[model samples]
Target: MFGILVSAFNVALGFVLRTVVVKFILFFGLYFVVQAFVPVLASLLPKSVDIAGLFSSLPDSVWFFVNMFMVTEGIKLMFSALLTRFIIRRIPLIG
Candidate 1:
């Protein structure tokens, strides 16, 4: 029984370390990096256009199609690909 308990604890610890801790560290690290670059990115966009109003003025039909597209796996896949690329580029030696 003690051996079984030890094994279970080991598995749980590994999962916590690998998934929980790593994701927490990665998320905040990436968030800070992106936040720092927001000003630089914003400078490249046009200042006159009201981006919020443009989206808000979209017709229901257009929004319906956009919602359908977002419900698909493509968005998640593309986002993950971008994140992977960003993470890869952040590495000192490999990048």
Candidate 2:
């Protein structure tokens, strides 16, 4: 019983450390990258049109949602691939 409890606790702790913490760090890193580059990217667009007006037309919520979605999907893919590799390594002999 103690062994089982210890195993469960370890698994939960590992998940928090490996998945949650790592994902949070990666998400913030990606956000900073985007924030740093967005102005540069915007400047690259053709200046004949009113880019500022187009950007201002959208509500802050829309940009937040899009950014969240992109970061989440990217993290999901990265985590899935990492989990798959872990599982593969754990497989008996075949791994």
Candidate 3:
């Protein structure tokens, strides 16, 4: 019973650690890669556009909700890709 409990604890700890590490890598890796395009994206915007006015029109609550939703979706998509690859590799016929 003790051995079984130890094994189960090890497996859970391993999974938790793997998840944290993978999420950190995926989040920051994608963040830096996307940040590299900031200048190009900025240049594409028309200089005459009123950026401040555009943001000022929206309520703070709306902005907060949108940002939260976008962040949640992005993380979910990134993790899903990792999970899909894991699933694909586990298929006996695929290997």
Candidate 4:
């Protein structure tokens, strides 16, 4: 049935698309955490690292933002995979 096949194909494609979107959103979220929290963490440090001063080193741009977004996405996926496995192993789910 072409209609059934088309519906199934759309569902499958949606799943695939969501996977990619999740990667990008999660990556940006992770990077946002790092960007926001690192300074707070640095404040607690002994002050030699000067990370607080490093924001000036990076000029804000479309390129920087996008590259960091991609890198952050990879980091997010890595951690999310690890965390999901760890939690799934510990928790039981009911259908």
TM-score of each: 0.47, 0.46, 0.41, 0.38
Candidate 1 ranges beyond 4 A from true positions: 46-95
User: For model 3, how does the per-residue alpha-carbon lDDT over 1-95 read when each residue is reduced to its tens digit?
Assistant: 99999999999999988998887887676567556655665577578957558757888888898687785477669967875575445444453
Against the reference, the lDDT scores of all candidates come to 0.76, 0.72, 0.71, 0.65
- Model 3: worst 10 consecutive residues (lDDT sum): 86-95
- Model 1, 1-95: lDDT tens digits are 99999999999999999999998898777778767765675587578966458668889999898778774466668867886676567655456
Between 1 and 3, whose TM-score is larger? 1
Local lDDT at 14 for model 4: 97
Residues forming the 10-long window of minimal summed lDDT in candidate 4 = 86-95
Worst-scoring 10-residue span by lDDT in model 1: 86-95
For model 2, what is the alpha-carbon lDDT of residue 12?
100
Task: Give the clash total for candidate 4.
Answer: 1
Off by over 4 Å in 4: 1-5, 48-95
The local lDDT score (0 to 100) that residue 36 gets in candidate 2 is 69
